[model samples]
Every structure is written in structure tokens, then in C-alpha cells.
Target: MYRIPFDRVNWTTSSFLIGTALIALFGLPVYLYHYGANWFLVALFFFYLIATMMSITVGYHRLFSHLAFKAKLPVRVFTLIFGACAFENACLDWASDHRRHHKHVDHDGDPYDISKGFMWAHIGWLMFKLNPEPPMDNVNDLRKDKWVMWQYRYVHWIGLVVGLIIPSALGYAWNAYHGLDPWIGALGGFLIPGIARIVVAQHCTFFINSLCHTVGRQPYSTSHSARDSAVMAFLTFGEGYHNYHHEFQHDYRNGVKAWQWDPSKWTIWTLSKLGLADSLRRVPDSKILLAEMREARRKAELHLEEIRQQQQPGQCQRASDKVHELVEKLAANYHELENAIAERVQLSREALNRWQNETRGIMREISRIQLLTPA
Candidate 1:
């Protein structure tokens, strides 16, 4: 029999996850049965969910892991608290693993390489030390931040207090004031939002690893297992644009197009305006356009080749006609896009947004043209 390596097991994490899961399964249902749907606490669950998830997505993932922008002390502290509440890990640990994931994605060295399978990437990697120890060398910059380090030292206790104790205390007080059993409020507020919320949050974060790789289009680069799923983006607060993310990991925005939903990007932008964020990084439109156009051309060529190898002569001719049309239109689109980007003036945020939308329009038109000559 293969003996369990007890030393290698992250007992603290394993016990917490199992304890919370059992509460979410057994405790939450019991509380709901007794309270008959405390919509108020349910709303609080969602509130905590959004807050903590954003802390991880915007604060930890983007701000800390990628250093996509610089945040003020308050902003950094805010992210650290709620990020701890997310209970994934300390910001240092989380960012280190994530940086490795980016540096060596879809490879054995990738912390959550999707090649291992969906479940493994989503949660199995966390079941044990399946991933190698993340090198601290990758996150030397984050370590320099005092707030990040403070949170690192007290992360577990911070998670318990901010994620559980506080909510439970408030719930108990509210219920006792209303002359109801304090335990009822405690259960609904603490267990549901505290434990259950972690489960839901973990999955939202996990979806970025699993669903992002499994379902979606790779418009920027197919060099890795990443892809952009708009549906997943909405679910994960805009982290689902994995294809663009993998292609341009340093870019501040995953949903680069103006029309896409990316609350995380918007939050960073908003903070900058409020002077709580600064030094926001962005990939120039010219570079983004270049990558998209190249990928489109590659796909078109592959499709044409597949069509050419087929037996149907009539189908072959039709496909050839469509391919030619696609190639011609794509070249035109590329030139127009390049010209627009080159002639751009002092671009304000609104101008930048408008420019992105127009670029997206041209890309969409190219897509329509490609469909006209379907393989």
C-alpha cells in the first residue's frame, strides 16, 4: 500500500477545507430549515463573496501576482484583508504559485497545469503538495511590501477573524436584538457566508484554472492551454479571459476590448482615479492588434488546409473561394488597424476606450468575413 506522506500533507489547509465543507453541507441546510430563508443573510453571503473574490482577483491576482498596477497603502491593505478571507493562501504563497503558473503554464512545472486534467487543475492540485514548492524568488517584489508581508505572517488568523468571527458576531447581535435565537443568526451569517462562501469562492477561482482552459476561444495565442470564455469571465469577475491573459500576462486588462465585462479591470481603473491606484500597465493597441491578426491568419490557413485535403471537389472550390476572401479582407483589416493606431493622438481614457471598441469592431468584421468562406 502507498503510505500517505503525513509531513508533505498541508494539514492546516486540509482540515479547514474539510471542516468548512461539512458545515456548508450539514450546518447550512439545518440553519436554512430553521430560519426558513434569511434572505438578509443570504444577501450578506453574496456581498462577502463579491468582496473577498475581488480582493483575490484584483488585489492578489492582478495587483500582487502580476504587479499590473501600483496600489496605495489603503488599497493594498484592503485587498490583503479580504484576500486572506478568501482562504486560498497568504498573498505571498498565492502570488508565488500564480507567477509560476504563468511562467510555465501547460507544462509539468506549471503549478496547476491543465494537462493533468480538469479536476486536478481546479482543486486536486490543492488536495496535497501535487505542485512543487513555489520559489520565493518569483515574488521578491511582493515581499518588499510591508502590508503583504504582515498579511503573510497572520494570514490564517486573519482569515478566521475577517471571514468568520466578525460576520458571526454581527449576525448574533442582530438576531438577539430582534428577539430571535442568536444561534440562528450566527449559523446563517457565520457558517453560510464564512464556510459556504469559501467553497463557492474557491470554485469561482478554480473555474479560471479549469473551465478557462477547457472551454473558450484562443483569439490571442494558442501556444498554451488558456482560452477566453465570456461566460466564465462573468462568473469569475473577469478573470475568465484566459487566452488574452496567457498571451499578455502583464497587460492590466484581460477583457481588452471595451465592451467586455471585467470588473477587476474596472476596479483597478477606478482606484487610479480615486488616487488609490497608480502606475497601471497596459499593452498598446498596436501590439494587441498584431497578435490577434496573426492568430486569425493562422486559423484561416489551418482551415483552408483542412478543406483542401477533403474529397469533395465542390466543397473544395467553395472553401477556396471563402479562404481567399478571408485572407484579402483580413489583410485590409490589419492595415486599417495599424494605420489607426499609428495616427493616434494624446489618448485619454475615453479615447482609449473608443479606440478599443473600434478595434474590436474591425476584428469582428474580420470574423464575419472569415465565416463567409467557412472551412
Candidate 2:
């Protein structure tokens, strides 16, 4: 692959510099002082942090980007507006970059490929000009939607105004109205929760593109750098299961298991039940189990090959026997599970289709009855 000349790239932007400087100077000091030097600020900061993080996870990632689930227009609009507060980017832009990353993962074209280097993958790439021309290909689908286009066009300004400026103004108003010192609210609301939250939120999201690919367990597939890290999930509101996400990008849920720590998935699921969202995508259990089985078998085969190459006859024999036993047990379990899951998925799909047809019929009948009665 041909490399773009570094000298040809424009490496600085006024907005990026201002944003970086504010975070480093004002945001960092406020966070350290409040979190360590003041307890009350810490509590306030954390509360806002959690809420904003969910806006990105539940709103940006699962809902907007992947369309893994369908949300009501009102709910969808709310998410898009608040999601901008994270100051990451517009949902359309963010989603476009993500889709491109998945499409060209591990290749030079992948926007955040860890193979490029940890820093580069995490946030360095943003420092350089990204094709200067608009990303028409990645976001063509979004352009047709006026709301998404509007957000994409003005996300940066909206984020700055609402996420930063408005909060500061509100802080001043409260101080004037209540006769409390405005500095306290300004520092607490604007600096600590607002600016500081952006820094932390951005890093937490970036870590999935960097740290997640660099560390954690790869029980599912070793073909990619993605990994499943519980710690990362906790920090990023359930985005830590990178391996599963990369493997099943279309699935709405990252942590497939009931016990998995995926607050984002839980939020979406609860909202779906309340009719705020619908069409939650999920990978079949059979497919996930089969993938796991295949990986395990691959590992066992490699281990056996190593033992055989070492010329340790007894060890090889014992290892071979163990592998054979394990494989047989796993195969039996896989087949049983697969058969049951396949049947369940088929039945579920049929039931859902029938329900949709019946509901439509009932609605049509009601309309006909009203027409026959005359106004």
C-alpha cells in the first residue's frame, strides 16, 4: 500500500487546538481539585458523567450507528441532541467513521487501526486532516434524513454551545438568582461536569479503539485485535466487549449473556419493552456457541501439533487423548444446543410474522367498520 506523505497533511486545526488546550488546562485542574481536593464536586461530576456516557452508548452506538434497534422519533431525536453533548462528533459522522473502521479493520484504511500505533489509533489520527473533503461515501445514507444532516452540519457548534457555553450561562443565572457565588457553580457545572466530562468521555470511547484492541481475552476469535474486557465495559457503558462487537456488529447487544455487564444493552432492552424502541437485533445463541466451539477446537489442534513436533511420545499421546475427549464432549454439546436454538429461532420468527399480520388485519377491519358506519 502507498503511504501518504506526512508533509502533505495539515496537522492543525483551531478548534482542535482550543479544545485540547481547555481540557488540559481548565478541565484537568478542575477534575483533580474537585475529585481529590473537594468531595461534593466529585459526586456531581460522576452523576453527569454517567448520564452523558449513556447518551453515547445507547444513543450513538447501538441506535444511530448500527441501527441495531428502532427508536420512536421523539426518543431518537432526544438521543441525537444529548449525544452531541458528549462533544465526540455528530451521530452521522461518528457512525460513518465506525462503519468504515469495521469495513476496513486491521487494514491501512481503518481509521483507528491499532496496528498503526496505540496513540495514533486512540486519538492521534484526529489531529491530521481527514480527506478535507466531506465523507460523502460513509454518510450518504444519512444525508437523505434531514434531521441527521442538520445534526451533522452543526454538531460541533451545538456541542460547544449547549455542552459548554449554555451550562456556564446557567451557572451565572443561578448565582444571580440565588445570591450564591457563581464561581462554585461555574467550576462545578461548566468546568468539572461539562468540559471535564468531554475529556473523560472522549478518552473512554477512544480506549475501545486502542486499549481494547491491545489487551483482554480473545476467546471468540484471534483473527482480529478486538478483545473482551470487563473493565473497559464498565468505563464505557458496555462497549468493552470489543471482540463480540467486531464479530457480530449487527447485533444490538454486545454482552450476550444475561449476567454480562452491559448497561447500554439493558437500557435499550428496557426502552424496547416500553415501545420506545423496536426491532432489537441479536445473534442466535447457536451461532455464538458454534463460534466459541470452533475457536476452542483450533487452539486444541495447535497444542497437539506442538506436542507432536516436540517428539515427546508419552506427552503427545496423553495430550492427544485429552484433546479427543474434550472435542467429543464439546461437539456433542454444540450439536444439542444448536438443534434446540435453531428450532427456537425459527419458531420465534414465524410467531412474530404471524403477530404482525394479525395486528394489521385487525387495524384494517376497524377502519372498514368505521367507514361502513358513515360520519
Best by TM-score: 1
Best by lDDT: 1
TM-score of 1: 0.86
List, residue by residue over 1-375, the lDDT tens digit for candidate 1. 967566667777678777878888888888777676566677878889999999999998998899899889888898999999999989999998898899889998888889988977987678778546655798888778888899999998999999999888878887898899998788677877788899889889989999999999998888898999899999999998999998988878989888888999999999999999999999987668667876776776666566566635444365456666666666666666667667874445675455455546544544454222324
lDDT of 2 by residue, 1-375 (tens): 967557545455436545765775866776567633244445656766776688788888887778888888777777777678787778887888888788888886688878988977887667665545445487676677777777788887878887777666765565666777777666556776677767787788888899889888776798899999899888778999999999998899988777779999998899988989999999875577567755665665565455456544333254445544554555555565566566765435564344334433432332232111111
Please give each candidate's TM-score: 0.86, 0.79
Clashing pairs in 1: 322-373
Model 1 global lDDT (CA atoms, 0 to 1): 0.82
Model 1 lDDT, residue 19, Cα: 80
Candidate 1: list runs displaced more than 4 Å.
Answer: 1-9, 311-318, 328-375
Worst 10 contiguous positions by lDDT, candidate 2: 366-375
